[model samples]
Structure formats: structure tokens, C-alpha cells
Target: MSENRLREDLCFWAKSLFDRGLTGGASGNISVRTEDGGLLVTPTGVSMGRLDPARLSRFDAGGRLISGDPPTKEMPLHAAFYETRQSAGAVVHLHSTHSVALSILPDTDPDNAIPPLTAYAVMRVGKVALLPFYVPGDAAMAEAIRGLAGRRASVLLANHGPVVAAKDLEAAVFAMEELEETAKLALILRGTGARPLEAGQIAQVVRKFEVDWD
Candidate 1:
């Protein structure tokens, strides 16, 4: 896609997330990798629901801001994916309610944030790491992501939100929705002794499904 079109698509995706109540106000950020290795990102302090395509921040492959206004304050969060995940083409962060709520539960796994209760979650997100909480926009948040490196594609920031990396903006958004859905399912099943998909079953789906949103 041309740089211009990529910007438009990202804005549309961002707005869709906001419209669907995935993220409210200006509480989320998204970025897409351009064909030339640069990035088109939503600007800091802008509402995801009303991002202007022409005003999206542009960053060269080397991480230099090349055009438009400055990028989101969570640049380090986005940069961690591009730097660690070889196939990541986009990164999305959202303050979706269920995912954040799940992250705070005392029983939530410190290593695996979401249970493999559904194949779609496993396919779209692989493993959602439960990262320790840090103040939003704090540099430590980025360092926490960096700690995960290549092992996971999505992470739930404890007491905060979920961040997902995908092959493109659309895939990133889709995966994030799945993350929230899985979280909601988990919440609804709590204390019911819900028979989650067995580990062997999850492995089978992982091997059989060609979910290449890497």
C-alpha cells in the first residue's frame, strides 16, 4: 500500500476500535509499518476515533521521526515489537475493559495472561504475556515489553491494557478484538470450573491452524 493509503487505513481501523468501545477517548494508540520500512502512527494526545490520515506521524526505519506531528508517548511500547518481532508490521495498544480487568485478577498467570480457552485466541494471539504494571507512558513499560522479546505476540499490561503485534494494522486490530473476547469469556467462566481446551488440544490447533499473523 502507498504511504498515503496506509495512513487512511490505519485511521479507519483506529476509529473502528473506538466506535466498538474497545478504547475510549484518547486512550489508545496504533501504528502500521509502511512498505518502505517507515511507520505511520497515530499522533500523541489525538483521539483514536478521529485521527487525521494526513497528520499521522511518520518514522523512518531507524526510528527517526521524519514527518507529521510527534508520535504517541508510548513510542517505546510500539518500538519494542518492531525491534524484537521480525515479522511485526503493526502494533496496537488499547485500554479495553475486560482484558485490563483480567490482568488484575489475583489468579491471572504472571507468564500466560490469557488461558487457551478458545482456538481463536490461540490462533490470533498465541500467548498473551502478563506484564507487571507500570505507570502509563513510563519508560519501564517499554522495558517490560522488551523482556518478553520474541516469545509472545500479545501482552496484557497489569492494571493497564493489552498490546498486540500483527502483520498489519487490520490484523493487529482483529487480534486485539480476539484478545478482549477471550478475556471476557474468561471472566464469564470464572469459578465455574470451565473446562478450558486441554493443553493437548491447544497444541493440536496450534500445529493445524495456519495462523500466520506473526
Candidate 2:
């Protein structure tokens, strides 16, 4: 997409996430790789619901801010994906309620954040790594994402939020929604003895959907 269209789409998806209560206040950020290989990103401190496309931050491939406002404090986190995952075209970080709640559950899997509860999660998000918590905007948070690097397409920042990288803006948003929905399912099924998809079933779906799961 053109830089202008990319900005408009990022703002549109940001508002959609906001409208759905996936993020509130100024707590989330989104970025996409422009055709020229620069980044078109949501501005820092602006609520996703009210983001302005023209005001989106711009960063060159070398990480220099070429125009617009400075990018979010979490720029390194986004940059890490672009550097590590060759296929990543967009990145989204969301402070959705249910995912944050799921992250705090005592028995939440530390290694594999979300269970293989549904086929969509497997197909959309692949395996989600559960990263140890860090202060928001900490450079260490980006390091945590770097720790997994190319091995995972999504991660749950323990006690913080979820971040997802995908081949495009639509895929990124879909993956984020799947992450939240999987968390919601986890909450609803907790202590209910509900059966999650078995390993064989998960594998079958993974194969059937041609998912790039790990």
C-alpha cells in the first residue's frame, strides 16, 4: 500500500480495536511497513480511538525518524520484529482487558501463553510465547520479544498485553483479535473441566489450514 493508505488503514484498525474496547486511553500502538520500507506508525500518547492518519509517525528503514511525530516509546519492540521476522509486514500491541486478565492467572503457562483451544488461534496466531512482565516502554520488554524472535508470531507480555506480527495490517488485526478471543475462552473454560483441542487435533488443524505454527 502507499504510505498514505497505510496510515489510513492503521488508524482505521486502531479505532476498530478501540471501538471494541481492545485498547483504551493511550495504551496501544500499531505499525506497518511502508512500500519504501519505512514504517508508518501510530503516534505516541494518542488514544487509538482518536488517531489521526496525517499525524502518524514515520521512520526510515534505518530507524531514523524522517517525518511526523516521534514514534511510540515501544519503537524498538516493533523494530525487533521487522529485523527478526523476515515476513512481518505489520505489528500490533494491544492492552485488551481479557488478555491482561488471562496473563495474571496463577497457572497460566509461562512458556506457551495460550493453549491450543481452537483452530483459529492455531491458524491465526500460531504459538504465543508468554514473556515475563516488564515496565511498560522498557527496552527490556523489546529484548523479551527479541528472545523469541523468529520462533513465534505472537506473544503475551505477562501482566502487560499482547503483541502480534503478521504479513499485513488485516492479518495483524485478525491475529490480535484471535489472541484476545483465545484468552477469553481460557477464562470461560477455567475450572470447568472443559476439554481443549488435543495435540493430534491441533496438528490436524494446523496442517489443514497450512498454518506456520511452531
Candidate 3:
């Protein structure tokens, strides 16, 4: 798609996320790869609900800022995904409530933070790594993700929220939503003896959907 269209789409979806309460109060960032191998990122401290397409931060393939406002402090996190995941066309990070709550819970799996509570979660988010918390906007968060070596596309930052990378902007947003919802499910079912998809069922979904569950 054209750069203009991508900008519009980015703003549209960012607003959708904010309006739906998936993110709030400038607590999320979105970035998409441009056709020229650059990036158009949401501006620093801008509410996703109120993004202006023309004001999005633009960066060259070499990672130099080309125009628009300064990028978010979380740029390192986004950059790590693009450098590590060859298929990543977009990256989204959100301070959604449920996912953050899940991250704080004791004994949450670091390898797969959210269980296979639903097929959509399995198909969209795969295994979500739960990383230890870092101070918000800390470069160390990026280093932790880089340590994953791109083996996972979704991660929950402990005491913070979730980040997801996908083939494009829309896929990234959808996967992030799936992660949030699955986290909600997990939280709601805690100590309720809720039965998650069994090992075989999860395997079948992963195999059928070709999920990047590693």
C-alpha cells in the first residue's frame, strides 16, 4: 500500500485501539514498515485516539529520522523486532490492562504467558513470552527481547504490557488484541479450574494454522 494510505490506516487503527480502551493516555505506540524500507511511527506522547497522520514520525531505512515529530522512547523495542524478525512489517506495544495484570501474577509462564484458552488466541498470538519488568522506556527491555532471537512474535512485559510483531500493521494489531483478550481470560479463570485447550488440541491448532509457536 502507499505511504499515505498506510499512515491513514495506522491512525485509524490506533484510534480504534484507544477508543476501545485497549490502550489509553498515550500508553501505546505503533510502527509500520514503509515500502521504501523506512518506517512511519506514532509520535511521542501522542494519544493513539488522537493521532494526526501527517504528524507521524518518519525514519529512513538507515534509522535516521526524516520528518515529523520525534518518535516514542520505546523505539529500541520496535527496532529490535524489525532487526530480529525478517517477516515483521509492523510492531505494536500497548499498556493494556489485562495483559499487564497477567504479567504481574505469580507463576505465570515465562515461555507462554497466556494459555491456549481459545483457538483464536492460539492461531493469532502463539506462545507469548513473559519478560521480566524493566523501567518503562528503558533500553534494557529491548536487550531482553533481542535475547529472544525472534523466536517469538509476542511478549508480555512484566508489570507493563504486551508487544506484538506481525507481517503488517493490521495483523500486528489483531494479534495484540488476541493477546490482551487471552490474558483477560486467564485472569478471569484463575483458581476457577478452567480447562484450557489440552496439549494435543493446542498442537493441532498450531499445526493447522502454522503458528510460530516456538
Candidate 4:
């Protein structure tokens, strides 16, 4: 996509997420890789609901800020994914309620936070790693993500929220939404012995969808 269109789509999806309460009050950040190997990122201290396309941060492949406003402090977080995952075209991080709540639960699996409650989650998000909590905007959070070795498309930051990487901005947003919704489902089914997809069923979905189920 053209740089102009990428900027517009970034704002469009950011606003949609904010409007639906997926993120609020400057609690989310998004970045997409450009054709020239640069990145278009949301500006720091800006609410997702109010992002201006022309004002988005632009960074070259070497990580220097080239133009527009300063990028979010969570640049390290976005950087980790792009650096580690060759397939990543976009990265999204959000402080959504349900995913954050799920991250806080004592029994939430660190290796796979979101269960196979829905096939879409399984296909889009694959395994959702749960990382230990770190202070907001800390570089340690990015290090934790780096530890995943690019194996996971989605991760739940303990006490924070979800971060997702995908092939494009739209796919990242859609995968993030699926992850949050599955987290909501997991929370709702907590302690009810809710039957998740059987191992065989999960395998079928993984195989049929060619999911990155590592």
C-alpha cells in the first residue's frame, strides 16, 4: 500500500478500536512497516481515538526518527517484534480490559494465555504467550517479547494487555480483536470447566488453517 493509504488505514483502525472501547485514553499504540522499510507509528501521548494521519511518527529501518511527532515510549515493544519476526508487517499493542484481566489471573498459562475457545482465535492469534509484568513503557517488556523468538503472533503482558503482530495493519487489528474476545470468553468460562477445543480439534484447525501453532 502507498504511504498515504497506510497512514489513513492506521488512523481508521485505531479510531475503530478506540470507539469500541478496545483501547482508551492513550492506552494503545500501532505501527506498520512501509514499502521503503521505514515505519509509520502512532505518536506518543496521543489517544488512539484522536490520531491524525499526517502527524504519525516516521522511522527509518535503522530506527531513527525521520519525521512527524515522536513515537510512543513503547517503541521498544514494537521494535522487538519487527526485529525478530521476518513476516511481521504491522504490530499492535493495546490495554484492552478483558485481555488485561485474563493476564492477571493466577492460573493463566504463561505459554498459552488464550485457550482455543474459538477457531478464529486459534487461526489468527495462534499461541498467546503470557509474559511477566513490567512497568508500563519499560524496555524489559520488549525483552520479554524478544524471548519468544518470533514464535508467537500474540502475547498477553501480565497486568498490561495484548500485543499482536500480523501480515498487515488490518490483519493485526483483526487478530488483536479475536484475541481480546477469546480472552473475554476464557474469563467468562473460568471455573465452569468449560470444554475447550479438544487436542484433536485444535490440531485439525492448525493443520487446515496453516496456523503458526508453535
Per-prediction TM-score: 0.96, 0.97, 0.98, 0.98
Between which residue pairs do clashes occur in model 2? none
Whole-model alpha-carbon lDDT for candidate 3: 0.94
Reference-based lDDT, each prediction: 0.89, 0.88, 0.94, 0.93
TM for candidate 4 is: 0.98
Q: Which residue pairs clash in candidate 4?
A: none
TM-score winner, 1 or 3: 3
Where model 1 places Cα greater than 4 Å from the true spot, the runs are 210-214
The clash count for each model shown is 0, 0, 0, 0
Candidate 4 lDDT, 7-76, residue by residue in tens: 9999999999999999989889999999999999999999999999999999997889999999999999
Count steric clashes of candidate 2.
0
Worst 10 residues of 2 by lDDT: 141-150
Candidate 1, residues 18-82, lDDT tens digits: the string is: 99999998899998999888888889999999998989999998889999988899998999888
Give the clash count for model 4.
Answer: 0
Q: Candidate 2, after superposition: displacement of residue 70 in Å?
A: 1.8
RMSD of 4: 0.8
Q: How far is candidate 1 from the true structure (C-alpha RMSD, Å)?
A: 1.8
Error of 4 at 150 (Å): 0.8
